[model samples]
Target: MAHRSASGSDRSPHPGRSLAGQLQHLDALRRAMARRHSLNPADMRLLWLLSDDRARTFREISEELNLEQSTVNRQVNSAARANLVQISDDQPARLVLATKEGIAAFDQDVDRSLNGYRQALERMGTEHTAEFNALLAEFIEAYRDIVQPDEEP
Candidate 1:
């Protein structure tokens, strides 16, 4: 069986093209969110993590975000300087927590970014959106397994 191309040329989509396209879209969304919030991905992630009440040490954040400890530490320092995060040295181990301002900022960004997605889901209908989300989750899990086989079952 032979396939014809639109321009009468034998052309095939490249393997992993779809995944790359999806990643590009995700990156674009992240950049748009950053621009809208005036914060970078690292800053936003830190705020989001802290907003979730997941107070953790630098090491824990590094592992959870799959970012280098040094990079995470630097962002934490920057956030602290910006009054977006507070360092509690009174604790046995220093903990990072989102300050009131950080929470407020994060909430605004969430409403702007995440809520937009929520609205899109609502427009898509519950059942269709649920199925789409489920499939996206499966694809992400499979990608993780492929990228980090040692961490997979």
Candidate 2:
């Protein structure tokens, strides 16, 4: 009978490495799908931003995202052409608002993307699922702090 290696050092999957790879892969897939849907990641973000507010100006989005005005303007124009959003001249600011279809699309995409993660969690058992979420949440917080930092009220 053949015997397997009992040594713990042989070949074991590193949870950290696996999770990192999965996160990178998922992010890439999301970006690719966004492009395929005739929207970029920034466009999706713009949709989300406008979903709540009736409108916002290029300057507002630029400041919020820390992107240049020209870059944000171009993204808005592209989204506008796709009918995912509409821009209008308003008193407060140049209004940028998501169309009804755009809102629905964003909602659907979010559900679809999260569904896979939900399934994986279900299969991972309760204890592991909780641990995984905690780790992922920690990483998310760290990332947000790195990118956005602490903003004063």
Candidate achieving the largest TM-score: 1
Candidate 2 global TM-score:
0.69
Q: In candidate 2, how many Å is residue 148 off?
A: 7.6
For candidate 1, lDDT tens digit of each residue in 1-153?
A: 344577887766766777799889989986776688756677788987777777888877888888998898899999999999998898787899889988888788778888878888999999999999999999889989888989845
Residue ranges of candidate 2 with Cα displaced over 4 Å: 1-38, 139-153
Best by lDDT: 1
Per-model lDDT: 0.84, 0.78
Looking at model 2, which ten-residue stretch has the lowest summed lDDT?
A: 1-10
Clashes of each: 0, 0
| Model 1 pairs whose backbones collide | none
Determine the C-alpha RMSD for candidate 2 after optimal superposition of all C-alphas. Answer: 6.6
Alpha-carbon RMSD to native, per candidate = 4.1, 6.6
State the weakest 10-residue window (summed lDDT) of model 1. Answer: 1-10
